[model samples]
Target: MDKKINIYKDVEALSEGFTSLLKEELSKREIVNVSLSGGSTPKALFNYWVANCKESIDWNRIAFFWGDERCVRPTDEMSNFGMTKSLLFDKIPTIDKKKIHRIHGENESKEEVQWYTSIMDKYLPKENGLPVFDIMMLGMGDDGHTVSIFPHQIDLWNAEADCVTAQHPETGMERISLTGRLVNNSRNIVFLVTGKNKAEKVKQIIEEREKFADIYPAAKVNPVNGKLFWMLDEGAASLL
Candidate 1:
């Protein structure tokens, strides 16, 4: 059974709720490992954490991981790890570099994928022979996709692997993403969605979770042993 599912009206409200939840998890577990997603909403929340909730995080005891990443150099501005560093790591003295497990997009993509998957397999909780992430943060695109799994990409949706590299149909850029199996095995999954453009799909996801499961990639997010929480602003929740 899931724990708690919630939605917020604004970023502040969402951040407040997330912060408290994170602290509670940290209090129970000495070492908290989290899988973070990229994009505008998360970038904003990362900045907010650095500026406001830095003290609330037990940085040294927390390990960072990415749910997905654009295949780009770490020094590239588009790198998810880079964004997190600029927004939070550099601002806080509580966390150590070694604690952050980044997806090496600049290296051989296949090798990097295998390496990271092994790391998760070795560290995360296991059930039915699959790694179970403690927490995973996700975002939805205007097209109703989440993480790097775009529409019409049947391989990504049904992948049984832990991780894989995929080509974005439109952008033609490569992406490294956790497979649905891994995502669905998490203990907690949070969707931080914003923007008016996402309202339609957000409504579709929340209302027709099973009906649209095939077309809307966002609807496929089913953490086997986790709670799925959606945090959205007014614009994103308008249709919901």
Candidate 2:
């Protein structure tokens, strides 16, 4: 796996960087499959894309998916699909509804996983018996977790399924998340992380890889036959 690190002065800079990267990726092919993450970091980036790139890009050629989502109604504020729709999707009238593949967060978690896995199999590009996303946008939690995979629930990192049910380590709220193997199969995996509170964990994951690499779930995001990019703001990259 090839890895790259990009540190920005702040969230605004990070958002701009992500937008530029997204545009570049979109221009590379006629159609692109992108998996988005839910978090404040990506929310800002989504807003940037909506305000700037919505009119410029060919939305019809892009397919949207989520890396993970809370088990709540799509109308709920905590819903990843809800946030993305409001911040990005809903604003773009040209985007195709058929291209938006969202997990039924309000449904039973296990069933939702199976349903989403089938959707991925049908829509996403397949390679080596796994769906290969063109781009997978991710965010890191303060606890070194990413895409609903927590430190305590490391088994999900190597799950054979393309998608699986996950639970928050503390709250135990159910979630549907793409398995780590599936995420690693993507063409590009970009992690957008911010906040000073995550500095130490980010440092341990990026700098002290040999030591904490096996412990932090975020550190396990090594894309197979793809590129991995870590886009961090000054706060998150402080300890690095």
TM-scores of the models, in the given order? 0.95, 0.96
TM-score of 2: 0.96
Cα lDDT tens digits, model 1, 1-240, are: 353446677887888777777887888887888899889888888878887877767789888898888899988999999998888889998897887889998888899889999888777768768886677888988887787888868468788678888878798899998888887877778888888899899888888888888987888987776788887888898886
Q: What would you estimate as the lDDT of candidate 1?
A: 0.83
Best by TM-score: 2
Q: Any residue pairs clashing in model 2, and if so which?
A: none
Across residues 113-172, which tens digit of lDDT does each residue of candidate 2 receive? Answer: 999999999988787678999999999988888998988887888998888888998889
Give the whole-model CA lDDT for all candidates, comma-separated: 0.83, 0.88
Reference-based lDDT, residue 168, model 2: 93
| Candidate 1: segments with Cα more than 4 A from true spot | 1-5
Residue runs of model 2 more than 4 Å from their true location after superposition:
none
